[model samples]
Target: MDAIPYLNIILRLTIWFLLTADLSVANIIIGISIAFLLPRHFASPEPLREWMRVLWEIIIAIPQAYLEAIQIMLRPHDEEEIVRERVKPKRTPGLIFLDIFLITFTPKTIVLKYEEQGWYKVHRVRRKISDQ
Candidate 1:
Protein backbone atom coordinates (compact mmCIF):
# COMPACT_ATOMS: atom_id res chain seq x y z
CA MET A 1 0.00 0.00 0.00
CA ASP A 2 1.11 3.55 -0.77
CA ALA A 3 2.23 5.75 2.10
CA ILE A 4 -0.20 8.43 3.18
CA PRO A 5 0.35 11.80 1.51
CA TYR A 6 2.38 14.54 3.21
CA LEU A 7 -0.70 16.67 3.82
CA ASN A 8 -2.42 13.85 5.69
CA ILE A 9 0.74 13.09 7.63
CA ILE A 10 0.99 16.70 8.73
CA LEU A 11 -2.69 16.77 9.66
CA ARG A 12 -2.44 13.62 11.77
CA LEU A 13 0.74 14.87 13.42
CA THR A 14 -0.89 18.15 14.32
CA ILE A 15 -3.91 16.33 15.74
CA TRP A 16 -1.67 13.98 17.71
CA PHE A 17 0.25 16.92 19.17
CA LEU A 18 -2.93 18.69 20.13
CA LEU A 19 -4.48 15.63 21.74
CA THR A 20 -1.29 14.80 23.65
CA ALA A 21 -0.84 18.45 24.74
CA ASP A 22 2.88 18.15 24.06
CA LEU A 23 4.06 20.79 21.62
CA SER A 24 7.76 20.65 22.46
CA VAL A 25 10.16 20.40 19.53
CA ALA A 26 11.13 16.85 20.48
CA ASN A 27 7.48 15.79 20.70
CA ILE A 28 6.65 17.49 17.45
CA ILE A 29 9.50 15.67 15.74
CA ILE A 30 8.31 12.38 17.21
CA GLY A 31 4.73 13.07 16.20
CA ILE A 32 5.78 13.84 12.65
CA SER A 33 7.89 10.70 12.48
CA ILE A 34 5.08 8.48 13.78
CA ALA A 35 2.51 10.14 11.52
CA PHE A 36 4.58 9.33 8.47
CA LEU A 37 5.23 5.79 9.68
CA LEU A 38 1.63 4.86 10.52
CA PRO A 39 -0.61 3.45 7.82
CA ARG A 40 -3.59 5.56 6.73
CA HIS A 41 -5.51 2.94 4.79
CA PHE A 42 -8.76 3.90 6.47
CA ALA A 43 -8.53 7.66 6.71
CA SER A 44 -11.50 8.52 4.54
CA PRO A 45 -12.79 11.97 5.44
CA GLU A 46 -16.48 12.28 6.26
CA PRO A 47 -18.53 14.84 4.43
CA LEU A 48 -19.23 18.17 6.11
CA ARG A 49 -22.97 17.53 6.05
CA GLU A 50 -22.61 14.25 7.94
CA TRP A 51 -20.49 15.90 10.62
CA MET A 52 -23.08 18.68 10.97
CA ARG A 53 -25.86 16.13 11.33
CA VAL A 54 -23.91 14.25 13.98
CA LEU A 55 -23.30 17.49 15.87
CA TRP A 56 -26.98 18.36 15.74
CA GLU A 57 -27.92 14.90 17.02
CA ILE A 58 -25.51 15.30 19.92
CA ILE A 59 -26.90 18.73 20.76
CA ILE A 60 -30.42 17.34 20.86
CA ALA A 61 -29.41 14.22 22.75
CA ILE A 62 -27.63 15.99 25.59
CA PRO A 63 -30.66 17.57 27.23
CA GLN A 64 -32.80 14.53 26.51
CA ALA A 65 -30.19 12.33 28.07
CA TYR A 66 -29.94 14.47 31.19
CA LEU A 67 -33.69 14.49 31.70
CA GLU A 68 -34.05 10.78 31.15
CA ALA A 69 -31.18 10.02 33.47
CA ILE A 70 -32.70 12.10 36.24
CA GLN A 71 -36.03 10.39 35.81
CA ILE A 72 -34.47 6.96 35.80
CA MET A 73 -32.54 7.67 38.98
CA LEU A 74 -35.55 9.14 40.78
CA ARG A 75 -37.88 6.29 39.95
CA PRO A 76 -37.91 2.90 41.61
CA HIS A 77 -36.29 0.17 39.57
CA ASP A 78 -38.61 -2.54 38.23
CA GLU A 79 -37.43 -5.40 36.08
CA GLU A 80 -40.88 -5.80 34.52
CA GLU A 81 -40.95 -2.16 33.49
CA ILE A 82 -37.85 -2.27 31.36
CA VAL A 83 -38.30 -1.95 27.62
CA ARG A 84 -36.45 -3.89 24.96
CA GLU A 85 -36.13 -3.01 21.32
CA ARG A 86 -33.92 -3.44 18.29
CA VAL A 87 -32.86 -0.36 16.41
CA LYS A 88 -32.27 -0.01 12.68
CA PRO A 89 -29.04 -1.37 11.29
CA LYS A 90 -26.26 1.07 10.58
CA ARG A 91 -24.56 0.72 7.20
CA THR A 92 -21.02 1.20 8.43
CA PRO A 93 -19.07 0.03 11.47
CA GLY A 94 -18.10 3.63 12.28
CA LEU A 95 -21.74 4.66 12.32
CA ILE A 96 -22.68 1.66 14.46
CA PHE A 97 -19.97 2.56 16.95
CA LEU A 98 -21.02 6.17 17.02
CA ASP A 99 -24.66 5.29 17.56
CA ILE A 100 -23.77 2.95 20.40
CA PHE A 101 -21.65 5.59 22.11
CA LEU A 102 -24.16 8.39 21.71
CA ILE A 103 -27.24 6.51 22.85
CA THR A 104 -25.51 5.02 25.89
CA PHE A 105 -25.17 8.50 27.42
CA THR A 106 -28.66 8.23 28.91
CA PRO A 107 -28.93 6.30 32.14
CA LYS A 108 -32.45 5.18 31.29
CA THR A 109 -31.19 3.27 28.28
CA ILE A 110 -28.44 0.69 28.23
CA VAL A 111 -27.32 -1.56 25.40
CA LEU A 112 -27.46 -5.12 26.65
CA LYS A 113 -26.37 -6.88 23.49
CA TYR A 114 -25.45 -6.30 19.87
CA GLU A 115 -25.90 -8.91 17.17
CA GLU A 116 -25.86 -9.21 13.42
CA GLN A 117 -28.78 -7.86 11.32
CA GLY A 118 -28.58 -4.65 13.35
CA TRP A 119 -30.16 -6.35 16.33
CA TYR A 120 -29.38 -4.40 19.49
CA LYS A 121 -31.03 -5.49 22.71
CA VAL A 122 -31.50 -2.33 24.75
CA HIS A 123 -32.85 -1.96 28.27
CA ARG A 124 -34.89 1.18 28.97
CA VAL A 125 -36.44 2.35 32.16
CA ARG A 126 -40.15 2.57 31.86
CA ARG A 127 -41.58 6.06 31.75
CA LYS A 128 -44.43 7.20 33.97
CA ILE A 129 -47.74 7.79 32.29
CA SER A 130 -47.61 11.41 33.42
CA ASP A 131 -44.21 11.83 31.80
CA GLN A 132 -45.32 10.16 28.57
Candidate 2:
Protein backbone atom coordinates (compact mmCIF):
# COMPACT_ATOMS: atom_id res chain seq x y z
CA MET A 1 0.00 0.00 0.00
CA ASP A 2 2.57 2.58 1.17
CA ALA A 3 5.21 1.26 -1.22
CA ILE A 4 3.26 2.30 -4.29
CA PRO A 5 3.23 5.98 -3.42
CA TYR A 6 6.95 5.95 -2.61
CA LEU A 7 7.84 4.36 -5.98
CA ASN A 8 5.82 6.94 -7.86
CA ILE A 9 7.74 9.70 -6.08
CA ILE A 10 11.09 8.05 -6.74
CA LEU A 11 10.48 7.58 -10.46
CA ARG A 12 9.24 11.14 -10.79
CA LEU A 13 12.41 12.38 -9.10
CA THR A 14 14.56 10.22 -11.36
CA ILE A 15 12.92 11.53 -14.49
CA TRP A 16 13.24 15.11 -13.25
CA PHE A 17 16.87 14.80 -12.27
CA LEU A 18 17.75 13.21 -15.60
CA LEU A 19 15.85 15.80 -17.57
CA THR A 20 17.33 18.69 -15.60
CA ALA A 21 20.88 17.39 -15.98
CA ASP A 22 20.72 16.92 -19.72
CA LEU A 23 18.42 17.96 -22.55
CA SER A 24 20.57 17.38 -25.61
CA VAL A 25 19.59 14.97 -28.40
CA ALA A 26 22.09 12.55 -26.94
CA ASN A 27 20.27 12.84 -23.64
CA ILE A 28 17.03 11.69 -25.27
CA ILE A 29 18.89 8.71 -26.75
CA ILE A 30 20.23 7.85 -23.28
CA GLY A 31 16.74 8.19 -21.85
CA ILE A 32 15.43 5.78 -24.47
CA SER A 33 18.25 3.36 -23.69
CA ILE A 34 17.36 3.55 -20.01
CA ALA A 35 13.73 2.69 -20.77
CA PHE A 36 14.79 -0.72 -22.09
CA LEU A 37 17.00 -1.45 -19.07
CA LEU A 38 14.44 -0.39 -16.50
CA PRO A 39 12.43 -3.16 -14.90
CA ARG A 40 8.68 -3.04 -14.48
CA HIS A 41 7.88 -2.14 -10.91
CA PHE A 42 4.65 -3.26 -9.28
CA ALA A 43 2.57 -0.80 -7.30
CA SER A 44 -0.08 -2.30 -5.10
CA PRO A 45 -3.61 -1.23 -6.01
CA GLU A 46 -4.77 1.47 -3.63
CA PRO A 47 -7.84 3.64 -3.24
CA LEU A 48 -7.95 7.05 -4.92
CA ARG A 49 -8.70 8.78 -1.62
CA GLU A 50 -5.68 7.14 -0.02
CA TRP A 51 -3.57 8.26 -2.95
CA MET A 52 -4.83 11.84 -2.61
CA ARG A 53 -4.03 11.84 1.09
CA VAL A 54 -0.49 10.60 0.42
CA LEU A 55 0.11 13.24 -2.25
CA TRP A 56 -1.04 16.02 0.07
CA GLU A 57 1.24 14.74 2.82
CA ILE A 58 4.19 14.86 0.46
CA ILE A 59 3.40 18.41 -0.61
CA ILE A 60 3.27 19.62 2.98
CA ALA A 61 6.44 17.81 4.02
CA ILE A 62 8.76 19.51 1.51
CA PRO A 63 8.62 23.07 2.86
CA GLN A 64 8.79 21.89 6.47
CA ALA A 65 11.95 19.97 5.54
CA TYR A 66 13.58 23.07 4.12
CA LEU A 67 12.66 24.90 7.32
CA GLU A 68 14.40 22.14 9.26
CA ALA A 69 17.47 22.68 7.11
CA ILE A 70 17.50 26.29 8.22
CA GLN A 71 17.23 25.25 11.84
CA ILE A 72 20.07 22.72 11.56
CA MET A 73 22.25 25.43 10.12
CA LEU A 74 21.27 27.85 12.88
CA ARG A 75 22.10 25.30 15.58
CA PRO A 76 25.74 24.44 16.07
CA HIS A 77 27.28 20.99 16.54
CA ASP A 78 29.27 20.58 19.77
CA GLU A 79 32.24 18.61 18.44
CA GLU A 80 33.50 15.77 16.20
CA GLU A 81 32.21 13.03 18.52
CA ILE A 82 28.69 14.32 18.01
CA VAL A 83 28.44 12.43 14.73
CA ARG A 84 29.34 9.15 16.43
CA GLU A 85 26.93 9.90 19.28
CA ARG A 86 24.08 10.55 16.90
CA VAL A 87 24.00 7.25 14.98
CA LYS A 88 24.57 4.72 17.78
CA PRO A 89 20.99 3.54 18.22
CA LYS A 90 19.96 2.40 14.75
CA ARG A 91 20.06 -1.36 14.09
CA THR A 92 18.72 -1.34 10.53
CA PRO A 93 19.13 0.68 7.35
CA GLY A 94 17.32 3.62 5.77
CA LEU A 95 17.81 7.29 6.50
CA ILE A 96 16.47 8.59 9.78
CA PHE A 97 14.82 11.97 9.90
CA LEU A 98 18.03 13.64 11.10
CA ASP A 99 20.12 11.94 8.43
CA ILE A 100 17.76 13.29 5.84
CA PHE A 101 17.89 16.57 7.70
CA LEU A 102 21.63 16.83 7.18
CA ILE A 103 21.40 15.75 3.57
CA THR A 104 18.64 18.22 2.80
CA PHE A 105 20.34 21.07 4.63
CA THR A 106 23.76 20.50 3.19
CA PRO A 107 23.52 18.75 -0.13
CA LYS A 108 26.86 20.22 -1.20
CA THR A 109 28.71 18.58 1.68
CA ILE A 110 26.99 15.19 1.71
CA VAL A 111 27.14 12.01 -0.31
CA LEU A 112 25.02 8.84 -0.28
CA LYS A 113 26.77 5.47 -0.38
CA TYR A 114 25.68 1.83 -0.32
CA GLU A 115 26.30 -0.20 2.83
CA GLU A 116 25.91 -3.95 3.15
CA GLN A 117 24.46 -5.64 6.17
CA GLY A 118 23.66 -8.76 4.12
CA TRP A 119 22.08 -9.30 0.70
CA TYR A 120 20.52 -5.84 0.74
CA LYS A 121 22.50 -2.64 1.02
CA VAL A 122 20.84 0.08 3.02
CA HIS A 123 21.07 3.62 1.75
CA ARG A 124 23.06 6.01 3.94
CA VAL A 125 24.42 9.50 3.57
CA ARG A 126 27.29 11.14 5.42
CA ARG A 127 28.76 14.60 5.55
CA LYS A 128 32.44 15.31 5.48
CA ILE A 129 33.92 18.25 7.36
CA SER A 130 35.75 20.21 4.72
CA ASP A 131 38.71 22.50 4.99
CA GLN A 132 38.00 25.84 3.46
Candidate 3:
Protein backbone atom coordinates (compact mmCIF):
# COMPACT_ATOMS: atom_id res chain seq x y z
CA MET A 1 0.00 0.00 0.00
CA ASP A 2 2.97 2.27 0.60
CA ALA A 3 4.22 4.36 -2.32
CA ILE A 4 7.77 3.14 -1.78
CA PRO A 5 6.80 -0.52 -2.16
CA TYR A 6 4.79 0.24 -5.26
CA LEU A 7 7.73 2.18 -6.65
CA ASN A 8 10.06 -0.69 -5.86
CA ILE A 9 7.83 -3.17 -7.65
CA ILE A 10 7.51 -0.91 -10.67
CA LEU A 11 11.25 -0.42 -10.85
CA ARG A 12 11.91 -4.14 -10.59
CA LEU A 13 9.30 -4.90 -13.26
CA THR A 14 10.78 -2.31 -15.57
CA ILE A 15 14.29 -3.65 -15.12
CA TRP A 16 13.14 -7.23 -15.60
CA PHE A 17 11.20 -6.47 -18.77
CA LEU A 18 14.02 -4.34 -20.08
CA LEU A 19 16.61 -7.02 -19.52
CA THR A 20 14.43 -9.71 -21.04
CA ALA A 21 13.56 -7.40 -23.93
CA ASP A 22 10.25 -9.07 -24.69
CA LEU A 23 7.39 -6.62 -24.98
CA SER A 24 4.70 -9.25 -25.25
CA VAL A 25 1.77 -8.71 -22.89
CA ALA A 26 2.30 -12.11 -21.31
CA ASN A 27 5.93 -11.33 -20.58
CA ILE A 28 5.01 -7.99 -19.11
CA ILE A 29 2.39 -9.63 -16.95
CA ILE A 30 4.88 -12.20 -15.78
CA GLY A 31 7.37 -9.50 -14.93
CA ILE A 32 4.79 -7.60 -12.93
CA SER A 33 3.68 -10.73 -11.13
CA ILE A 34 7.20 -11.78 -10.22
CA ALA A 35 8.09 -8.30 -9.07
CA PHE A 36 5.20 -8.34 -6.64
CA LEU A 37 5.96 -11.86 -5.43
CA LEU A 38 9.66 -11.23 -4.83
CA PRO A 39 10.66 -10.61 -1.25
CA ARG A 40 12.08 -7.15 -0.70
CA HIS A 41 14.98 -6.99 1.71
CA PHE A 42 15.84 -3.42 1.04
CA ALA A 43 18.74 -1.57 2.57
CA SER A 44 17.88 0.66 5.50
CA PRO A 45 15.86 3.62 4.37
CA GLU A 46 18.27 6.07 5.93
CA PRO A 47 18.23 9.70 4.95
CA LEU A 48 19.20 10.46 1.34
CA ARG A 49 21.97 12.66 2.74
CA GLU A 50 24.03 9.70 3.92
CA TRP A 51 23.44 7.81 0.68
CA MET A 52 24.55 10.82 -1.36
CA ARG A 53 27.68 11.20 0.73
CA VAL A 54 28.60 7.57 0.14
CA LEU A 55 27.87 7.90 -3.58
CA TRP A 56 30.15 10.95 -3.81
CA GLU A 57 32.93 9.12 -2.02
CA ILE A 58 32.61 6.17 -4.41
CA ILE A 59 32.70 8.46 -7.44
CA ILE A 60 35.83 10.19 -6.18
CA ALA A 61 37.56 6.89 -5.41
CA ILE A 62 36.67 5.12 -8.68
CA PRO A 63 39.16 7.01 -10.84
CA GLN A 64 41.99 6.26 -8.46
CA ALA A 65 41.01 2.60 -8.46
CA TYR A 66 40.99 2.52 -12.25
CA LEU A 67 44.40 4.18 -12.38
CA GLU A 68 45.78 1.62 -9.96
CA ALA A 69 44.37 -1.15 -12.12
CA ILE A 70 46.00 0.31 -15.23
CA GLN A 71 49.33 0.64 -13.47
CA ILE A 72 49.18 -2.93 -12.22
CA MET A 73 48.31 -4.28 -15.66
CA LEU A 74 51.06 -2.28 -17.42
CA ARG A 75 53.69 -3.44 -15.00
CA PRO A 76 55.24 -6.64 -16.27
CA HIS A 77 54.55 -9.69 -14.21
CA ASP A 78 57.09 -12.00 -15.79
CA GLU A 79 56.14 -14.60 -13.27
CA GLU A 80 52.67 -14.70 -11.85
CA GLU A 81 52.52 -12.47 -8.79
CA ILE A 82 49.50 -12.87 -6.57
CA VAL A 83 49.19 -10.94 -3.37
CA ARG A 84 46.56 -11.33 -0.71
CA GLU A 85 45.39 -8.40 1.34
CA ARG A 86 43.29 -8.49 4.47
CA VAL A 87 40.63 -5.84 4.32
CA LYS A 88 39.82 -3.99 7.48
CA PRO A 89 36.36 -4.36 8.99
CA LYS A 90 33.90 -1.82 7.74
CA ARG A 91 31.45 0.10 9.88
CA THR A 92 28.44 -1.75 8.53
CA PRO A 93 27.51 -4.87 6.60
CA GLY A 94 26.17 -2.67 3.84
CA LEU A 95 29.53 -0.93 3.53
CA ILE A 96 31.39 -4.23 3.40
CA PHE A 97 29.06 -5.49 0.67
CA LEU A 98 29.47 -2.25 -1.28
CA ASP A 99 33.25 -2.37 -0.94
CA ILE A 100 33.39 -5.97 -2.19
CA PHE A 101 31.44 -5.08 -5.31
CA LEU A 102 33.48 -1.91 -5.89
CA ILE A 103 36.83 -3.67 -5.51
CA THR A 104 35.76 -6.38 -7.99
CA PHE A 105 35.27 -3.66 -10.60
CA THR A 106 39.01 -2.98 -10.61
CA PRO A 107 41.02 -5.01 -13.14
CA LYS A 108 44.02 -6.29 -11.20
CA THR A 109 42.36 -7.66 -8.13
CA ILE A 110 39.60 -10.18 -7.47
CA VAL A 111 37.98 -11.15 -4.20
CA LEU A 112 38.84 -14.76 -3.54
CA LYS A 113 36.89 -15.30 -0.36
CA TYR A 114 35.63 -13.65 2.78
CA GLU A 115 37.58 -14.81 5.79
CA GLU A 116 36.00 -15.70 9.11
CA GLN A 117 38.03 -12.96 10.75
CA GLY A 118 36.10 -10.25 8.95
CA TRP A 119 38.86 -9.85 6.37
CA TYR A 120 38.46 -10.15 2.64
CA LYS A 121 40.79 -12.44 0.76
CA VAL A 122 41.76 -10.41 -2.28
CA HIS A 123 44.04 -11.78 -4.95
CA ARG A 124 46.08 -8.92 -6.41
CA VAL A 125 48.44 -9.12 -9.36
CA ARG A 126 51.71 -7.43 -8.47
CA ARG A 127 55.16 -7.73 -10.01
CA LYS A 128 58.38 -7.00 -8.16
CA ILE A 129 61.08 -5.48 -10.37
CA SER A 130 63.73 -7.28 -8.31
CA ASP A 131 62.25 -10.64 -9.28
CA GLN A 132 62.93 -10.04 -12.97
Candidate 4:
Protein backbone atom coordinates (compact mmCIF):
# COMPACT_ATOMS: atom_id res chain seq x y z
CA MET A 1 0.00 0.00 0.00
CA ASP A 2 1.95 2.97 -1.32
CA ALA A 3 1.16 6.34 -2.87
CA ILE A 4 1.40 4.78 -6.35
CA PRO A 5 -1.74 2.76 -5.84
CA TYR A 6 -3.63 5.76 -4.52
CA LEU A 7 -2.40 7.86 -7.40
CA ASN A 8 -3.40 5.17 -9.88
CA ILE A 9 -6.87 5.01 -8.40
CA ILE A 10 -7.24 8.77 -8.56
CA LEU A 11 -6.01 8.91 -12.15
CA ARG A 12 -8.36 6.14 -13.21
CA LEU A 13 -11.29 7.74 -11.44
CA THR A 14 -10.57 11.06 -13.08
CA ILE A 15 -10.39 9.47 -16.50
CA TRP A 16 -13.65 7.64 -15.83
CA PHE A 17 -15.40 10.83 -14.82
CA LEU A 18 -14.10 12.68 -17.85
CA LEU A 19 -15.13 9.90 -20.19
CA THR A 20 -18.58 9.43 -18.70
CA ALA A 21 -19.21 13.13 -18.02
CA ASP A 22 -21.35 12.13 -15.09
CA LEU A 23 -21.41 13.57 -11.57
CA SER A 24 -24.07 11.33 -10.06
CA VAL A 25 -23.46 9.30 -6.93
CA ALA A 26 -23.96 6.01 -8.75
CA ASN A 27 -21.43 6.96 -11.40
CA ILE A 28 -18.94 8.04 -8.79
CA ILE A 29 -19.38 4.78 -6.89
CA ILE A 30 -18.94 2.72 -10.05
CA GLY A 31 -15.89 4.71 -11.09
CA ILE A 32 -14.28 4.23 -7.69
CA SER A 33 -15.04 0.51 -7.72
CA ILE A 34 -13.62 0.07 -11.20
CA ALA A 35 -10.55 2.05 -10.39
CA PHE A 36 -9.85 -0.13 -7.37
CA LEU A 37 -10.65 -3.36 -9.19
CA LEU A 38 -8.41 -2.71 -12.21
CA PRO A 39 -5.21 -4.76 -12.25
CA ARG A 40 -1.84 -3.00 -12.22
CA HIS A 41 1.41 -4.71 -13.00
CA PHE A 42 4.72 -2.99 -12.43
CA ALA A 43 8.04 -4.66 -12.94
CA SER A 44 9.69 -2.43 -10.35
CA PRO A 45 8.95 0.54 -8.14
CA GLU A 46 8.82 3.83 -10.05
CA PRO A 47 10.56 6.69 -8.35
CA LEU A 48 8.40 9.67 -7.45
CA ARG A 49 10.92 11.98 -9.14
CA GLU A 50 10.59 10.06 -12.39
CA TRP A 51 6.80 10.19 -12.14
CA MET A 52 6.94 13.94 -11.53
CA ARG A 53 9.23 14.39 -14.52
CA VAL A 54 6.77 12.53 -16.68
CA LEU A 55 3.93 14.64 -15.28
CA TRP A 56 5.87 17.77 -16.14
CA GLU A 57 6.47 16.47 -19.64
CA ILE A 58 2.72 15.86 -19.98
CA ILE A 59 1.96 19.42 -18.86
CA ILE A 60 4.47 20.81 -21.33
CA ALA A 61 3.12 18.66 -24.13
CA ILE A 62 -0.33 20.31 -24.04
CA PRO A 63 0.91 23.69 -25.29
CA GLN A 64 3.40 22.00 -27.60
CA ALA A 65 0.57 19.96 -29.09
CA TYR A 66 -1.48 23.09 -29.76
CA LEU A 67 1.47 24.73 -31.43
CA GLU A 68 2.06 21.69 -33.58
CA ALA A 69 -1.59 21.71 -34.62
CA ILE A 70 -1.37 25.36 -35.57
CA GLN A 71 1.82 24.78 -37.54
CA ILE A 72 0.31 21.85 -39.38
CA MET A 73 -2.71 23.94 -40.32
CA LEU A 74 -0.61 26.87 -41.44
CA ARG A 75 2.06 25.00 -43.36
CA PRO A 76 0.98 24.20 -46.88
CA HIS A 77 3.84 21.89 -47.85
CA ASP A 78 4.50 19.05 -45.47
CA GLU A 79 6.21 15.68 -45.51
CA GLU A 80 5.42 12.50 -43.63
CA GLU A 81 8.09 10.11 -42.49
CA ILE A 82 8.60 7.23 -40.12
CA VAL A 83 11.38 7.59 -37.61
CA ARG A 84 12.80 5.64 -34.70
CA GLU A 85 13.06 7.46 -31.40
CA ARG A 86 15.11 6.32 -28.47
CA VAL A 87 13.13 5.85 -25.28
CA LYS A 88 14.26 6.92 -21.88
CA PRO A 89 15.93 4.24 -19.77
CA LYS A 90 14.34 2.21 -16.95
CA ARG A 91 10.74 2.59 -18.03
CA THR A 92 7.84 1.15 -16.05
CA PRO A 93 4.45 0.33 -17.56
CA GLY A 94 2.98 3.65 -16.50
CA LEU A 95 6.01 5.54 -17.73
CA ILE A 96 5.97 3.72 -21.04
CA PHE A 97 2.27 4.47 -21.47
CA LEU A 98 2.89 8.11 -20.70
CA ASP A 99 5.77 8.22 -23.14
CA ILE A 100 3.59 6.90 -25.89
CA PHE A 101 0.74 9.20 -24.85
CA LEU A 102 2.99 12.26 -24.94
CA ILE A 103 4.35 11.38 -28.36
CA THR A 104 0.93 10.70 -29.82
CA PHE A 105 -0.70 13.69 -28.18
CA THR A 106 1.00 16.04 -30.62
CA PRO A 107 -0.68 16.67 -33.97
CA LYS A 108 2.46 15.90 -35.98
CA THR A 109 3.43 12.55 -34.50
CA ILE A 110 2.02 9.14 -33.58
CA VAL A 111 3.78 6.09 -32.23
CA LEU A 112 3.26 3.07 -34.40
CA LYS A 113 4.90 0.59 -32.04
CA TYR A 114 7.79 -0.02 -29.73
CA GLU A 115 10.73 -1.77 -31.25
CA GLU A 116 13.33 -3.95 -29.58
CA GLN A 117 16.14 -2.31 -27.58
CA GLY A 118 14.22 0.79 -26.49
CA TRP A 119 13.07 2.41 -29.68
CA TYR A 120 9.70 3.78 -30.68
CA LYS A 121 8.50 3.60 -34.30
CA VAL A 122 6.94 6.98 -34.86
CA HIS A 123 5.16 8.49 -37.82
CA ARG A 124 5.61 12.24 -38.08
CA VAL A 125 4.63 15.09 -40.33
CA ARG A 126 6.81 18.16 -40.77
CA ARG A 127 7.01 21.17 -43.01
CA LYS A 128 8.93 20.45 -46.18
CA ILE A 129 12.15 22.35 -46.34
CA SER A 130 13.03 24.15 -49.56
CA ASP A 131 16.55 24.53 -50.92
CA GLN A 132 17.46 28.18 -51.17
Best by lDDT: 4
| Candidate-wise lDDT, in order | 0.63, 0.45, 0.65, 0.86
Q: Per TM-score, what order, best first?
A: 4, 1, 3, 2
Name the TM-score of candidate 4.
Answer: 0.87
lDDT of 2 by residue, 1-132 (tens): 557445444545456456669767876666656654665444334444544554465566677667656655776433332122234233222223224333433422332432343222223233445589
**Tens-digit per-residue lDDT, 5-119, candidate 4:** 7666777897799999999999999999999888888678788788788889989999998988888778753688999999898888777888998899888899999876899
Badly placed stretches (over 4 Å) of model 1 are 1-47, 77-90, 128-132
TM-score of 3: 0.51
- Count of clashes, each model: 0, 0, 0, 0
Query: TM-score per candidate, in order?
Result: 0.53, 0.40, 0.51, 0.87
Best-fitting candidate, measured by TM-score? Answer: 4
- Candidate 2's error at 124, in angstroms? 12
lDDT score for residue 34 of model 1? 87
Cα lDDT of candidate 4 equals 0.86
The candidate, 1 or 2, that scores higher on lDDT is 1
Please identify model 3 stretches exceeding 4 Å from their true place.
1-38, 42-50, 78-93
Better of 2 and 4 by TM-score: 4
Residues 19-110, candidate 3: write the lDDT tens digits. Answer: 89998999988998889898766755434444455556768778978797678677874444444556553334444555676667566667
- Residue 17, candidate 2: alpha-carbon lDDT: 54
